[model samples]
Target: MSTTYLNLARKWRSKNFDQIIGQQLSVRMIKNSLYLNHFFPVYLLAGQRGCGKTTTARVFAAAINCANLDAFQKNPRLTSLPCLSCESCKAMEQGNHPDFIEMDAASHTGVDNVRQIIEAASLLPLLGKKKVYLIDEAHMLSKAAFNAFLKILEEPPSSVLFMLATTDDQKIIDTVRSRCFQLFFRAIAQNDLRGLLVEICQKEEIGYDEQGLQLLIRETGGSARDALNLLEQVRFSSDQITEENVLRVLGCISDDQICTVLYHVFSKAKSPQKLIEYVDEIKLESFAPEIVWHRFIVALKIAVWYKYGVSSTGLVLTNDLKASIEAVPLSQAVRLFDFACQQEQLFLKTIDKHLFLSMFWIRLWSMVHNQEAEITSLVTSKSMVTASIDSKLTVTDQLVATSEQQRVTISANSSLWEMFLEQITQVDDQLIVSLFTQAKLKNYDTESNKLEVSFHKKFELFQDLFTKKDAPWFLLLQEVFGNGIQLNPVFESESIVQDVKPIEKKVVDQSKKQFYQSNNSANVSKKDIPLDISDKTAWAMTHALLERFPGTVTEFKEETDE
Candidate 1:
């Protein structure tokens, strides 16, 4: 006759407090309570699933009723308790202890079940000194059932001990929770979890790769049961556990594959067709779309972290892949991460997951491609200006030219002043050009060699670029116009009010009036102001809006009280 095979999770279930993994605090507290011989009438164990709450409860139950618990506690050197050799411990381990009753509150959530437990609790222990009731998923019990058992739970007989284990403690009534001695179990740490898996693999005679085990550890998400179950699945699928086999069994993409996709997306490639080809080549469609998206999100998040030099020890990336990810800008990585997160909700709701995923890849490629094109365009323009400046004059030549020009007095309205403005326009910086071009040459005193440049109040925030001596724009200005020229920057009202002719002002004021009237009138259509108006401030405002927004202006009615 053949014996039935047991899976790794059940085969390796924690038999005692010592065997329990990743819950040292709870185990120590329970053992300390056992040593003092002080037992709480009601004990509450709460945590996420598979973090050893239920296991610890069972161990505590067995230890309290063990025949040799007193002998084990008396010795300081022996840390292991429950004395598995004792008959009570053996019976509890075999699930045949009469004094120990284990209940699944999830199945028995009604008041009738609570009444039966209450009646059972009224009786004394048959096999041991103390009777223990271990309730798993205690949070699933209905409010009525909790109420029915509250009296017994609050003040159980001295011979009976009640242990309640739940993933969610909040669902349990506050009165019951207040009565119990609560112990929270935290999720297992990754290092401790990895050690556990390594030990299990060695004991089971399972061959494994480091990367394969790391993947298993990640997939487990700090659950020992999940880790063991996943390991069993991988072991049964293949004799030797490897990353390739893990991916095959899980039907998920590898980190390298994700890095490859990110590389192509962040690369100079314009089309996503290559990405589609690569996906088809890898047979990505065979993998679950949800899992693919989940991995993609996680990979992007890791890339963002790596880009910032954050310590990401668990991320298994090749050196080349790491370099590629680090090569991408932090802004781009953050944007991709944010976009992926935003699309996740939509992706889950989408029925055509494959189509949505393909489009997602395309959108990512488009974002990077468009951003790259813009950057390239800006760089090209700046590079051309830089080359022109470099070819025209050296730093020494520029100083000489400025000194020569300074010897001759130049008025604000003179041709020399226009040439100075033209020289500023030739500088490689766009912000300097934009600001200086918008500025009005307020005055130029030839005696003091002082140049007063005034800007509209709207542009006041940029005054530092011109006033600061160490600023790049200021240095460039000095290099071009000579160090003797003192630049005083000031903010004033629009130049139209101070400089425009009376007739032009009237025309602009009328145009503004008509603009506001059009916006206020619901029946009227939007009308374009005449381009011939010579109000530089108005034109500057219009040009700024057009350049910044790059769209047609639509009329919106202003609300008014009747």
Candidate 2:
């Protein structure tokens, strides 16, 4: 009542049946019903909040009660379009129309209100052509209220109509819902939001930056009223809205802060305290922990998308992630995103809220430095890998002793590739040995040191077993003695293995350099990769130390927001 010009949400409110956005779908069904003469006494509009269910129901009430809907009845779409110039439309808009009765179920939420409303349904139209009952927040109605009202709604007077609106459809008793025609409204789209904001600015006579408008739309996440209210706040302080101003007003973290944390994650920083402290500093800038967590989640998701050669424009992301993320590896970024999302869900659903935030930072740390601080301890626990001479997997033989050196020879005498078959049989007999199976070597490249191996479709079982990354453990000749060499483990989409290529000089010297490179995820750098181990003595030394210095991880600070 105090404002001069109507804001966008009010000024642009649907005047007719067709003007409603994200709800044209619900309008069509009502129009079709009107055209076919299949009139229902009550209609239920249901969806999440800020999704146009209540708004569309209001427009529907006006349409059916339009005083000037004379010749438009043939084309039902025109029949329900209200003429606001008339007494009935003007009265409905002001919530004073005798025929257009609006009720807030939250206030009139008992059996007594329902009994009175049902008794009023017996009367004919008091002012408009038809009486319309608009019930908002219908889910809040008590069971006694719904049970009492259901009778009149299911079989109402011919002149009476009922419209129920609710954010949660599940809370509405099933008996009441089944009697009424239902319509579902969806969330507004980002592009739809952009046009809505620009239209609002032009109508309100407010000057704003396009980037600032983008920030408003991104921040609102599909709620038009919320976005316009944010715009109103920005206009109060300054005529021209800047990106920085919007971030400040919204208590949003900046792109610089997002990038700062990301750099630590990528560098495999061990100090979890540093990341937590950085987040705490942002809190002094008045940013909420939830928002800080959201920014990181958005940054991580964008990084993953960028790595996949995809663009994040128009995607749902925090504005703080605008230019900070775009070049991280897809695999690593996705891994981080998954970790962030898991934490986010926990933060939302858990009573242990403090642990939620702690887990968030720890997850990022663990992505790079997840294993125990000592390499020897981690390898020894698995028993799958052993420490080599100096905890280096550049070469090792936990599978066999150096003394069991049986030089392998491939005789070029059989069409079936006898040498390859023998190697596969030896490996398969042992359950732990997984690698290349009963297939011909096909060809070998000594110059490039690449083995050109192929598996046919008919031999699917053999192909799966033979081409697996774990195949090398079985002493497959190509993997074990490729060009007179032992290979470091190689990780591929199809397999994980240590490829060994021996030196061309001497057998004695080549065996001495037999190294294994045990790998996990490969998107990380060598230094960031977990150090591999093979010998038992080093692991024993490190485990003892870790036990002596038992590490305890606790929350660096109590949660700021309850």
Candidate 3:
């Protein structure tokens, strides 16, 4: 004779409030309500999936209709409200109680189904003192169905109790929600989950590794049902549940593989070919792309935490892996983390996940390499500037040397500001480049390391863009200038232009007119025209643009009043 096998998840389902893990507050509240006999007409239980919302509803339903409920209510301290020995408790436990109705709102999400529930709720109990209705996934009910339930919920029968369980309570209509007493359930704590797994392993005589169990808990994301289901799968896959077996069962890439990828990502060597080869190897292993990507994201998070000197107790890192993670700067690690997070949805949506991941790896490699080159260049330039400053310093007077150093530092900052402006044109976004170009460098204060940029009153939008801390342009400013440097955005007053001297304005207007006339005249010689300060600045800007873009000037049509 062969006996049938039951999965751990179903076999270990919570039978009572005390048996429900990770929901002490909800259990206690329900127990207290039962003890006081102060039941709400309707109750709303909401939480994440596998966090025991539906299970709590079942337990609460049984407790209310239990034949021995009066005994617990009188005692005030007895937690076993539903004496499972009675006929009512036995019927509920076997899922055959006539008075206890469990409706799946996901399937019967219609007005007619709700009408049937309302009609039945009006009838008296057949097997117990009170009739209990458990509506699972109550948020799945259609809007019309929720409206149909409003009247019955607001004026429910004295002997009828309605319990609604939902993973997302926000979708439930406000009218229905207003009538229900809400109880929220939180995810199981890691320690509580660990203890539950330990007890299950002991009871089932399953051999396991502590690290492997921790990995399971991490993957389950505080879902008890998922944890038990995964545990059963791992148990049957191997004689002993170890980290390697768990990884195999989960179809997740191993930690060593994840570390290898991180090493290539953060290492100084440009090894795109090796990274692609490794990705191909991962694909050959038949690992799930989503799981692989998720593991990579998790590894990046751990690397970021390590980079910031925050120790993660869950992860056990080898010395080499720790060294590799520690070698990466916090900024680079955070960028990689953000990139991985953004790519997750795209990776899952693509049909050819391996191809997408290969491209992703290449892009990530390019980003790291580019950032490394930029940092190296910045460091080299700073060293050269420092050498020049030291070479010019005199040893005769200490105060004079200090003053000279300050002047050189200020000069270097001015050169850095120019470099920043030149680099802005290289950005891929033309709109951002145009906005940045409109900003004038008004002042640079070395004392506060502040760069005050003034925008014309007409460019208020550009000024607002730079003021936002999360804006990409603002972040780029900090990246070019040191993190300590601050940006002060000033908007020039509309009337400020009226303060300019008439003579100076006339000279500027005359210089601009001559410059345009010279460009438009074919008979004029360029050398014969003397250049003013404004003309010199324009020529300098044009030469810089030509040097950076390396293009011929095909057209030079000046703007005119048409």
Candidate 4:
């Protein structure tokens, strides 16, 4: 209060609902609620940092608890907004109100701390009729603390009002969230911020360059508090606030420097070397790597936008930079931007910043070089292609036929299976090859013009694939051969084995032979049959038992006639 200077963010913080910016709809709804006397017991204000969640909460707390509201309510013509001169409003504004409680859950994030609030809610208001509890950063409350506070929030006393403000509303407990009415605050736009900054500068009588203010607007990323803080830094740096002064103070790159770096990246043949030189030059000027990287990314985006005729707002660039940016191809610009973003992620993870950045520039340069080489090779190949067409006419003539007219004649010596496998591997990898190779080539009937393929019972997956009319594999087979080739897929069925008389066993012991004969009497139970688990014929029965019965394996039998 004694200091000559007051920061713009603090001095301009909204004191009443009418002064709140960028949240017109939210503010209007809150005001309407007050006018209708339909105040909810608990209210939740959610938004990003510096978007005025806490500020709005404080103003709403003051308005609802203002002692003068009764008189204003009686006279409908008078303003229902909070009168700052009233006893309750002044106490709230000065942070001395006994009824208004502001608890920052970030520091006090325990069950016991929340218990204190629950205990205090039982007491009557000391100065005003309503007790306002403003819990900022409410998401930071511990789970146990939220559970303890949930009851009070769900059914608070009629004299109490709970206002919870948080940046991340999702972190708040669902039960607690459902009990409260929610309001969302949005970030202030660039134009709104610019107007506010211009007004502040005019009010403070501070000389500022228009471009310099624009830079501050972009740097702050639409946060009014951040913008004001940055403006204060720039205003303190020099007498006149100019773009160069702002860049110097903030350790940001200038537009010309950014353009110089990008132009060398796009126009110079040895881009990596040029980029290295420019980076060194910028470092010598004391530009931070992060700032340089941010500016470089912005410049690359401008190039992309310029190339595609898209607008790049809130950025003031020189005509030369715009021209150079517009000249780059959209694809190259996008690639460079994407590469920079990828490198930036890596840069954030590594401890060795210098080496990573150097390698990043080198990689970018190599990408450009590779693309240039590819383009050159494509052009060269196109020019030489016409010259070789006459020599390759015989080979080309056989391969270039319309789908309906093409007929591939296979030699008698050629193995159809080998040709099909070779063509399959070209289109797909080993996965598809493994799936198809299981099918046995039954026969290629030249007279019927059908390719008969038989699959084992275990290879039924291949049969299913071939049955699809529009599967890629089928189309690929037709393309490799001719459209006239018809595919006939067959699944070989398992045949039942008839009963065979058991061979006479060599009698080991008289008792053992008699016991075996009794167990295998004329009427033999299915479970009494000796199991041949190792035989391939028993696999299906074993699998069925394992799938149906799971763990119990009392008996396993071979295929038998029904």
Candidate 5:
């Protein structure tokens, strides 16, 4: 075969408005204007590559001055159908039209180049009723060139029509864009691209599997030109186009292999070694890690969509594969998807892709498995604790019923301390519970109504906090043991006194000074001090501040001056 043979993209170039793909809005607007013989002096068609902007402009140009345009004006539906036999239409098709001028603004971007077009716009057409100037990549024109052509582009001669096509509309100045009737083109749909590919294969007498054609459509990202070009390459390489051939040619992982990887990753019986084996198999098949990772995410997303009752047409997977993917919890699938995305950017920049991929899989596996194990352990522990607590409450209820016959006496030390722990647990005071766990009930006196507790050297810092005569801990202790009971906190080591001595005196002096000054007295004896409930409540509020503000209360004082 000679290289001179036309490629699929050129061979199947859209000749009329109806033949153009994925440009229905632009086509409808232009065709309606053509039908009414109402032409804009300047028209801007904008979109990405291979989206039919220039082709639509050319077709509209030929249709504007077609020999049989009268027939089209009579029937609105037939306006886009230009007569190919007309002299002007044939010239436009051959790229030799006298009335239809196509200028690539990319190459001719200077003011001199635009000036020529502006000068030519005043002349009369040699071959047709309207002279058309189609400028592709119009955004490439320089600022001076755009400024030079701005006047003529806004309001041109009666016989002249200007058509501009660009991939980026933002690059074009607003003043120039405002003057033109702008229409936007979009990417071709996968379904439409598939149908076009099928028609091309049928016409070219090429054999292609359904999956292979679908893969081509996906790889092209909805570009008709790109799909056709890929199709031509596949056809030239082999007589039969299969999934394996498409994967090999595109350097992508096959859908089956992708399904296999995800199945093992999310399966209940999944093991780390099994996942590693799958990665090795993919590596042996010459698949790039980045492509494999991308395919995994795509397949995982499709499964998630299906799980949520959304459309899953694009994905090609077996029933077993579908079931395996659906077995993954939605939360886990979402988390893995997020993690894979984070790793994707890193994978691209790393020098050792395979090593990076292996590390990523191992990290993901460990995190997922550890999370499942922790959740299971937490549930089991909660259930066991609930059962034990229920059994204990049953016995305590029976004991309470017999309280009149045999009074239940709560000991002032261990038994009362246990009750305090239970009360704080009921109130959800976890910080209090943690501190009490390290304390030891040393003694209790009935005559003086005093209770003493000992703490290890580590808890010496918090001893004075709980030892306050009206602290919340003392209140709870007195309520459980008896009213008027004082709490004496004892440290196990004398060295703790030195460590805590600096702040202890500061707190005592400030509290004593504040209390004495409030009574207008310098001396207040312990016997003369009335231990009223209201006074205890006030001290309790101060201790509450100690717990609230933490380290700041080492030397107690109010935060805001009121």
Candidate 6:
């Protein structure tokens, strides 16, 4: 019945042509039409969500009505500021206005609805100069409805005006869209969003850090509505907004953490399966893999650009990208960037991201091999740096190892490639046994320190699931092999373990804390083990903690904690 002090979104809703941000092209065209005093039969506004197409149309309608907003208190209308004293504006505000109609195409998508509206359009405006029709989510209109709307658009009545808003224009029938003057709405940028959020926070007297605002802007992905909602959540949680709160509330992974993981995974030879381990966690947070992957490619591109001293503020690269590009090499950085782009294309078009990732790692390892090849070929063929080459090889060999014992000891020096191999050979060998049985290891290079395998499946998850860190098998591996040591499990025939334990667990009256099977196999719970951090999940987590977080994990198996 009444208006409340407008929230950030409504309070700052665009008033006129100049108020809308980052939509210069749309604004210019619309304003020119208004100034020229020429009106299209139908005006279609299309783009991604929260881009303010509806606001502009409202403003245009209000201006036409010469609506005064002051009469309605805080509820201001853009047209003539929507005259509150006028019966027409009052009716419109009440949504009972005969002259102003708001139709949600999503609900009224039937042809009958379009026919009714068209029939109404034949008559003159009862309370205003021009009858205004605002159809939201126009893409939802049915085929017959679209045909009716199209015929109307193709031969629109002079007294009627139409504004169609949609998040996706492609879904709208081409013939319907063709008759309307189309204006595209784009996602607002981070900086603009930051400034907007700051202004709103100040207006609302909500305290927030610039960093918090920045995070909200980034996490909201330039949707004004989403950003405002997040800002409101921050305000409600605490007057003071912190980065921690932003991450927890928005479930946004910081650029730093994402980059750290990206660097470790993309720079060196690591399995894409490792990335997938976090996918479910991310999905639970409502994060899209396609978006995250695209964002990562942007980060890699920025890193590449930074290495070359050429900065590119490209699309998909977020606000945190520039800082991440520091200290990277041009060729490798660019290679990774290109790889990310290629990977994104594959992920978007085909579900075969696993193969794309495996190929990527193989290619990166090739670079190291190529480095050695270049040196050796230069030394032998050109007779140019044989001594230097020999010395480098000596160091590499040392780094490579002291003996086969040390060479394949499940250490972190195996470039992640060999680390994976070590797990299968000396460790559980069960998971890899399955993969190797099914996989065709077409190539293995001692010098390159890489392995190539192929699978018949088209989806990436086949390879990813087999080696994901959260997978039950991963817990088993981390318990056996450690962290930083990757395990790229390719799918193969299931490793048939015939080494049956001599125990069968039969239900017996409880006497012992643990039960022994007929095969002499013991199935013990964590209770049987010492306060036993014996669960595979917990064990894997502990190892990860020790690796990723150093000083915090000081000592392992501290006498009592178990």
How many steric overlaps are in each model, in order? 0, 25, 0, 0, 0, 18
lDDT of each: 0.77, 0.63, 0.77, 0.73, 0.73, 0.61
Off by over 4 Å in 6: 1-7, 10-12, 15-18, 67-87, 266-295, 312-562
Write down the worst ten-residue block by lDDT for model 5: 404-413
- By TM-score: ranked, best first: 3, 1, 5, 4, 2, 6
Model 4, range 1-562, lDDT digits (tens) per residue? 6865658888888898767778888888887777777799999999888878998899888888876666646663568578898898889877899999999999999999988988889999988878999999999999999999888888899999999999999999898999999998888888888888888899889899888888888887768888888888888888777898888888887877777766666653434545787778777347666877777788778777777777776355666666655554455567678778877887878886666766666666544443343333444565478558754445554445322122222222124456667768654334456556666566555446587766657656545456665766776666433355688877776532324676555644676878987666664434445544565344654654455357644454433334
| Top-TM-score structure, candidate number | 3
Give each prediction's root-mean-square deviation over alpha carbons: 14.8, 20.6, 14.1, 14.3, 15.6, 21.0
Candidate 3: residue 438 Cα off by (Å): 11
lDDT of 1 at 149: 79
Worst 10 residues of 1 by lDDT: 407-416
Cα lDDT tens digits for candidate 3, 71-111: 88888565476778899889988889999999999999999
Report the lDDT tens digits of candidate 1 across residue range 313-418. 6456666667666655566577678888888889989998988988898778755553334334444565578678775657786677555443332321344345
Candidate 5 lDDT tens digits, 224-317? 8888888877777788777777777778877777677666666646666678887887673366767766776787678678667687665677
lDDT of 3: 0.77
Q: Which of candidates 1 and 6 reaches a greater TM-score?
A: 1
Candidate 1, superposed: residue stretches over 4 Å from native:
316-329, 371-562
**Residue pairs whose backbone atoms clash in candidate 3:** none
- Per-residue accuracy of model 2 over 1-562 as CA lDDT, tens digit each: 6867876567677677766666667878876665565668888888776767777877777767776666456765444467677778898888788888889999999999988888898899977767888899999999989999877987899999899999888999999999988888777777787787777678778888878888787888777667777887888878876777788788887767666766555543235556667667766336655676677677666667766667776344443343333333344456567667666666888775544665666556544443222232333444444443345434345434321221111122122234445555554233222234422344433335444444434434333343444445434544333323222222233432234586567876555555322233234332223434344355554444444467532333222222
lDDT-based ranking: 3, 1, 5, 4, 2, 6
Write out the backbone clash pairs for model 4. Answer: none
